[model samples]
Target: AEVCYVGVTSSAPSSVARTPEQFTQKLDAFAQKRADVHGQPVSTHTIVSPDPIADLDDDLIKAIKEVGADLVVMPTHPPKNLDVIMPSHGGKVATHTNVSVFLVRPRDG
Candidate 1:
């Protein structure tokens, strides 16, 4: 499977502890580890945006297309009541993208 790992960083100062470079390095390391485990080639990409979570549908879609991914596997949590009022980023991506998307909720350790 063609795998593309994407990371987003914000320019504005906030409580985020990770720097943009650190975030990119983390993304690269994660992709490398996945590739090693799956024995498949992987690519890493980072997007610098003002809002990391919001307004990322377009960028995410573009990255998906650029990677020519057949399926998108995204980590997402169960929806809350507030999710009805404002959809999550994964929800927006599913709505906008044409490819198949699989949302995985992390398991408790």
Candidate 2:
């Protein structure tokens, strides 16, 4: 059973209180729901980060390294402006990290 680390990073100002706690609460609710459906073997972790959510390639790489994760599976939302120089965050993470990244594009409804 592969362990999945679900990360939600917030770019909110540092003065905000209970931000991480709120994130944890949300994650706990989500995990509980999934656990109820999937039974005990469903392994998932919630990583609540206070740093900026976008373009934190180095931080992502470092964290995954600490956990000995060889692969990073992420979803790429369609970019609002296609002309932006840098690719998606997942793309940048691919080039910069010492790990492998798998990216999936969400289909528009």
- The whole-model lDDT of each prediction reads 0.79, 0.65
Candidate 1, superposed: residue stretches over 4 Å from native: 12-19
Model 2 gets an lDDT of: 0.65
> Residue by residue across 35-63, what tens digits does model 1's lDDT show?
99999989988877888667477778878
Tell me the lDDT of model 2 at 40. 52
Q: Which lDDT value does model 1 have at 5?
A: 87
Candidate 1, residue 79: how far the Cα is off, in Å: 2.1
After superposition, which runs of candidate 2 have C-alpha atoms over 4 Å from their true positions? 11-18, 40-51, 78-84
Question: Which candidate number has the best lDDT?
Answer: 1
Q: Tell me, by TM-score, which candidate is best.
A: 1
Candidate 2 lDDT for residue 92: 79
User: 6-98, model 2: which lDDT tens digit per residue?
Assistant: 555564533433466666566667677777777754444445455655436656766676677778988888776872876777877788777
